[model samples]
Target: MHELIVIEHEAEAGLGFFAGWLEGAGVRCEVVRPYKGEPVPERAGDGLLVLGGAASAWDDEGYGWLPATRALMARSVESGVPTLGICLGAQLMTIACGGTVERGTAGLEIGAGAIEPLPEAADDPLFSALPAGPWRAVQYHYDAMTALPAGAVRLATGSQYPNQAYRLGERAWAVQFHPEASAGIFASWTGTSDMDPLRVADLDARVREAEPELEATWRPFAEAFAAQVAME
Candidate 1:
């Protein structure tokens, strides 16, 4: 069976729905908890799934394992390993490549919002199934990928962040939003973050209502990644 190396940055940002999705697809996941002092491997497994975190990508001093994690991601992308980077993971990939990441000028995008598929995504293996209209997804990042890596294909764009999703080379993909987050996981983030109470409540309600749709849309995307790994 194929294995996907899942990197967990923190305890709060666990795999959520993605765990079941990968298991159902027959992809075994070996999760590395760097926050717990587990060392990140020099090489990736058959595939890689880099989860989100609260720490910035450039905060190497605070998170000592970040440098190794970034190196592994860079190597995976360059070697054509099936790699998926989420939120902070996406920002890390951006910096690993020739791109840039910084505090978002548009402010923190921390709720359920719509991401429209770009024309380039029409033939993308993971994004082609998405509708042309704005597709609802959960967002919780304060930093954003200001620029894409050289030769990267932009997949989706949102109102707050233009670089919502992109594909690096033929195998690596990065998403600024949290497709793996369940309603409960999102709610946990909302409660811990310093945000307006009313806005938090509203977002919690909206995301809870959109749970089914989120599963329906992202499950297939996860499955597609698994299938690619299985084939390889």
Candidate 2:
């Protein structure tokens, strides 16, 4: 079976629903928890999956394992390993490949938000499956990729963040939103955040209502990624 080397940076943000989606599509995942002292591997397996986290991608000093994680992501992209980076992982990939990431002046973009696929994504291997119109996905981030790598193809955009998703080289992709996140996971995030209790409840309720749509949209997306890993 095809296996993806998953770099999970935090406990709350494990693979969540994505693990089951990938496994159901016949791809296995071996997760490496850097927060738990598991070293990020120098190389990847059939594919690489770098999940989101609370720490900023550039906080190597504070996170300690960030430098190695960035190095691994760089190597994965350079070596043509099929890779998918989400949120913080996307920021890491951006910085690792000479792109820019900074705290969004627009503030935090939490809860379910609309993501519109760019014309460039029409032919993309992973994003081509998305609808032409705007679609909703879970989001929880303060930083944004303000600029893309030199050769990266912009795939998706949003009202708040234009660089929502992009493709680097032939095998790697990055997304600012959390496609792997479930409503329950989102509630966990809101629970720990400093947001008002009423706001948190509203956000949680929104995600719960959007759960079916999230599954319908991202399940095929995960399977598409697994298909790419299978071809490797």
Query: All predictions: root-mean-square deviation over Cα?
Result: 1.0, 0.8
lDDT of each candidate versus the true structure: 0.91, 0.92
TM-score of each: 0.97, 0.98
Candidate 2: Cα lDDT at 18: 92
What does the lDDT read for residue 64 in candidate 2? 93
1-232 in candidate 1: lDDT tens per residue? 7989999999999999999999999999999999999999999889999999999999999999999999999999999999999999999999998899999999889777898888898888888755454688899988999989999999999988899999999989999999999999999999997788998899999999999989988888888888877866
Quote the positional error of residue 116 for candidate 2 in Å.
Answer: 0.8
- Clash total of candidate 2: 0
Per-residue error (Å), model 1, residue 192:
0.9
Best by TM-score: 2
The true-versus-predicted C-alpha distance at residue 151 of model 2, in Å, is 0.6
